[model samples]
Target: MGDRRALETQLAVVAGFENPQARLEQYPTPPDIAAHVVHFADLQGDVDGRTVVDLGTGTGMLALGAALRGPRRVVGVELDAAALDTARDNERRVGTTTPIHWIRGDATRSPLCVHSDGNSETTVLMNPPFGAQNGRRGADRGFLRTASELADVSYSIHNQGSRQFVESFAADEGGEVTHAFGATLTLDRQFDFHEQETRDLDTEVFRIRWT
Candidate 1:
């Protein structure tokens, strides 16, 4: 509607969707951070005419934010059914005609063949699992690999500790890291294991392009 700042405030008003017991780690990206990522993506590549995809769109913040940028289409790919329902609710709340589509499947293995709409450039935005839990290692790699396959450019979020690993993985997937920045992401306590009501973690946001 207005500037990116104004859109951020509007996004802050929307509800976040979450499921604590998911097999994959579930952390909704903070509204401010989501807005910031989308704003940066807009600057890097004009999101207005591109097809934007949010790979692990937990609550659709990134997808909706891209929608605010007037993208031609915004697709949110998520595995959790509950999360999808919440995302749909969020779409209604936003009250815009932005073409948003929801695809329910694993981010790592979702079939991408049918989405071959010709000529439109694609930009992916995802806040994937950090793989901190047992057996969840390398989860981010799957998201990166898929992004490389489906989009020309991607903005992925990961832990600061995983910077090297992420960079290496992207390079292997024929991606070049064009830009990155450090940020603190706020996580509200949503599980029994969490000791604090809210915690902030050091995180990195990366912008990569398919080489």
Candidate 2:
């Protein structure tokens, strides 16, 4: 609602508030990155007055952040029931009047219902799993495909290693990378396998527009 710094501060309160279960590849998108993504989208004139969908919205950080900017509507799609419960709690705490619809479903199979607002564009924002874990390879692509199919624009965060695959996949789905930036995804030790107190992951943020 205010400046970028204020928004970041608001979103940052959600960090580490509720950690995710590891089987789901559930890591909350850090507040700073979430703020950056939302703010950048706002600056592009894509968020305000638009319908924003947050695919795999772990705890609704991105969805809530986007809602704060006064979108027409916001929907958060998350499969994990636990995460959804937490998200609902967070939404109530923030006390925002902006409508945020939380759906419990698998993002890969989720279908978007576009409510047209006189040419106001739809934007899909996501931080999908990188699929680095066993048996979950190419997970991010599904979100990308779904976003491309439904939204006019998509902003996503992925492992740096997936850069080439993402670009190529976007082109195949009738979209092109309009902008991209890199960041460090600071991951706190959530799983048993994580030995470090925190790990910094090389990540990329992409803004893709459909043709």
Candidate 3:
């Protein structure tokens, strides 16, 4: 509703995961980054009056950000029940009028139907797992695959050096990368293996238009 700063302020109250799962790379998206992405999407005429879906919505950060905007409806698909519970609480705390549909299911194989007719549009937003963990490589690919199948346009975050991978995948899926940008993800130590108290990860965000 307001500027990016105002949106960030509203999202400041959104909480992180209580019991972080290492396998899922469960790190909360920074409020500033979320605000920036949502504001950019809004400016591109992607948020308002569209059905916005946030895949792997950890505590509803991006979903709530879009909700505060003028989206017709929002859907958050997450596999973690605990995370979804926290997301519901966050939604109440944010107190946005836009309705959000929280689905407790795997985001990669989301149970959402495509609504990409000329009259209606679907926008997918997500900060999917970066495939950092061993044996969990190419994790974000599944999320992108889902977006390709279900979204008219999609915005996603990935590791710093994933530009080539993302571009290649998007091209293969009949999508074009319209925009790309860099960001920093500050992650606090939430797992046993983390040696540092906090780590700053260089990341990238991409906006792709599916044809």
Backbone clashes in model 3: 0
lDDT by residue (99-172, candidate 2, tens digit) is 99999988998856774558577999999998878888888988998897778999999999677888899999
**Could you give the candidate ranking by lDDT, starting with the highest?**
3, 2, 1
Model 3 spans with C-alpha error above 4 angstroms? 117-119
- Stretch of 10 with least lDDT, candidate 2: 13-22
Per-residue C-alpha lDDT of model 1 across residues 54-161, encoded as one tens digit per residue: 998877989998998888888999988988899999988887699999999888886554243564688889999988888998789889989989888899898887
- Cα displacement (angstroms), candidate 3, residue 153, comes to 0.7
lDDT (CA) for every model shown? Answer: 0.84, 0.86, 0.94
Q: Tell me each candidate's RMSD, in Å, in order.
A: 1.8, 1.5, 1.0
Error of 3 at 158 (Å): 0.3
**Candidates 2 and 3 compared by TM-score, better number:** 3
Query: Residue pairs in steric clash, candidate 3?
Result: none
lDDT of predicted model 2: 0.86
Model 3 lowest lDDT segment of ten: 111-120
- The candidate maximizing TM-score is 3
Give lDDT tens digits, candidate 3, residues 1-211: 5799999999999999999999999999999999999999999999998999999998999999999999889999999999999999999999999989999999998998857666659999999998889999999999999999999899999999899999999999999999999999888899988999999999999999998
Candidate 2 residue-wise lDDT at 4:
81
